[model samples]
Structures are given as structure tokens and as C-alpha cells.
Target: MTLDFSWAGEKGCVSLFPNPEFHLENVPAGAKSVSLTLTQGVREMGGEELPLPRNGILPAGTFRTFAPCNPGVYQWTAQAKSATGEVLSEARKARYYPSDEVAEHKP
Candidate 1:
């Protein structure tokens, strides 16, 4: 499923925290549905604006956009659920570099 991956905001650096324990914890033992979400924040990128959506998830394999604004250092997470609407999996974090177009970057 495609995860709503996104950064917290605009910045020079970002950090992630995805339980490096497993990947694609497919439908839990008895789940009938699944979902994903992300929690992020940033320090720089100006405009007091941020990038990526507030939070959400997607199918199994695809590219989705969270928020829309600028590009820079971003922190995000990928989560999944089951059909029963149970948190089948935990959330994970990671640093993302969408592009290099800020006024000035230092990393």
C-alpha cells in the first residue's frame, strides 16, 4: 500500500523513527482493513508554511502526497492497520529529501 509519506516542514536536517524491526507487516493475523499515517515537524524552510499532509495512509505500493508547500528536510512515518480496524502495525519514521530549492541549504 502507498503510505502518505511527508516531512514535518522546511529545514536543513530531519530525523525518523521507524521500528526497524519489520517491513510490510501484511494484514495482521485477523485484520480485514489497513491504514497508515505520519507525524512530522520542521524548523526551517521559511514562509511559516509546511509540506506534506496532516496524516493518512494508502493502498500497498504507490506514491502519495501528504502536504503541499515547499521541499527540504522532512521526517515521516509509515503505519498500517487491519480489516477489523485494529492497529496491526506500529508507525515508523525516516528522513526525506524531496528536493534542493530552498533559499540556502547547509546539508
Candidate 2:
């Protein structure tokens, strides 16, 4: 299983908002649903978590686009699970920086 995604037009100089899009590819046959999480740093920023997909669960094989997030380095995760909440497969990516100089970013 594979998950592809991108954060659309996120720039602090222009805007602090992010519009993220997702594309699911080769989902496992045993998977019943998928959940996507985008975390800003280790803790919720500005008193809130990044907005998640409605209900937090998407049907398998869903190709969704257009979600909002804050501009910063983040930890992104996508999980595939069975009906009983058992994880079938999981994908993780780290060291995501919205800015080119994210290492020195303050927000």
C-alpha cells in the first residue's frame, strides 16, 4: 500500500494556511478504512490540532484533496486498519518542513 500527498501553497510570507491533498494508491485488500494525521511539532500549536478529515476515517481507496494545515515542520502519518481497529499497514514520514529554512523557523 502507498499514500501520496502534498501541502498546497503553504508559505508564511504569503499565508499561514495550508491546503493539503491526498491520493491513495495500492491499498491493502484487508484494509477497511484509512486515517490521516498531520501533527505540527510534538504538541498542538496555537491551541489546536491540525484539522483532520471529517470523522477521522475515510473509506478505503479514497482519493481526497483539499485539507487545511498550519505552516511549519510536521510529522505526517497514514494508517490502514481493519474493521476491528487492527492495523493492516502503516506509513510514516518525518522531517517535513513547510518552509525552506524550517530549521530556524519560529512558528
Candidate 3:
């Protein structure tokens, strides 16, 4: 499968903030869900693992994959994992898209 990261930065450069916009293609059979994560070096930013639709076909084109809503230099990973958490296949992309929104306060 192919993964596309949506963040605003020059190609192969570090990007600040989070952009949930992502795209996936050619997901393999027997895959249970797609997990997306953002990281700055060894630190976790945020992530999500979403189950595929009942038809087994994902949404067309681009969609928000996960909400890594923190500001930092982060790289992204998209993986197709089994129900038992075995990674089937994965893709990684660095630095794509931009956003101005931050996570809301919960006080």
C-alpha cells in the first residue's frame, strides 16, 4: 500500500504542527485496520487506528487519517495491521500540508 502525508513543508524537510489529511491506496486483503501515527524523533505526537468500512473499500481520494494535534517536527507512519496487531505492510512519508488549528482546551 501507498501512504500520503499532508503537511506543509519542503520535500524531505521537518514540519511543525499536525495535518490529519492522508490518503491510502492498494490496501491488502486480510488487513483489519489502518494505523496512523506521528512522531518527533522518539516522542509520540498522536495517532489513530481506524477500521475499514463494511464493504472493505476505503473512502475515495483523501481523508483525515488521524489527529496528531501537536506542534513539532514529526514524521508519519501508516500501517496495515491484523486484529492480533501483526503489521502486514506499512508506508512512511515526511513533511506534507499545513494547519492553524490546535486542540481545544478541556478545562
Candidate 4:
């Protein structure tokens, strides 16, 4: 699975404000639910779990929004679990900068 960040740049840089919507891709079949977790350093920022559709499939364009409290590198984890106890997970890292920091680096 892959994590899509709505506010991320090409190099995995994110902005501090407006937060970001996280999207999943390549979710496996038979997934009953999915969960998203965000962390910075050793602190967990936020997390949520969403049940899949009645067909046991994730809907197209389904997404979760997470708020970052500070500017730094964040780790994201997405996990999908099936009724049979099968789990699929993916992780990614992104650097977040303050709005002013982003503006200063803009080309």
C-alpha cells in the first residue's frame, strides 16, 4: 500500500497549515477495516480507523485527514486488517515545514 499526501511536495515535504488528507492505494482485497497513524519523533500526533464498504473493499478516493502540531519529520503508518487476522501495513516519512519556512524555500 502507498500513502498519498494532499499537501506534500514532490520530495515528500509538507506544509504546517491546512493539515493534510491521507489517501491509500493498492489496499488488498478482503480488508474489513483500515487505520492510519501519524507520529513525530516519539509522540503520536493522531490516528483513526475506518471500516471498509459493505463489499469489503475500500472506496475509490477514500481518505483521512491528520493534523500536525509542529514542524518536523513525521512518520505515517497505514494498516488494513481482514477478519481472518491478516494484516497489511505500509509506512512513509515526510518532512513538514512551517508556512513561512515553505514560503521562504519556494522557487
**Candidate that scores best on lDDT:** 3
For model 4, residues 7-50, the per-residue Cα lDDT tens digits are 33322233322334556667687777777666666667666677
Q: Rank candidates by TM-score, best first.
A: 4, 3, 2, 1
Listed in order, each prediction's TM-score against the native is 0.36, 0.52, 0.57, 0.58
| lDDT for model 2 | 0.47
Model 2 lDDT tens row, 10-87:
433333333244555666666666666645655532211222243333332233222224445664466777777677
lDDT of each: 0.33, 0.47, 0.57, 0.53
Model 1 per-residue lDDT tens digits across residues 39-79: 23543222111122223323222333343234434433433
TM-score of 1: 0.36
Give the higher-lDDT candidate: 1 or 4.
4
Candidate 4 residue spans exceeding 4 A from truth = 8-19, 53-67, 98-107
The reply for model 3, stretches above 4 Å from the true place, is: 8-19, 53-72, 96-107
Off by over 4 Å in 1: 1-27, 42-64, 99-107
Model 2 residue pairs with clashes: none
Query: In model 2, which runs have C-alpha deviations exceeding 4 angstroms?
Result: 10-19, 44-71, 94-107
The window of 10 residues in a row where model 1 has the poorest summed lDDT is 45-54
Looking at model 1, residue 80 earns an lDDT score of 45
In model 4, where is the ten-residue run with the lowest total lDDT? 98-107
**Number of the candidate with higher TM-score, 2 or 4:** 4
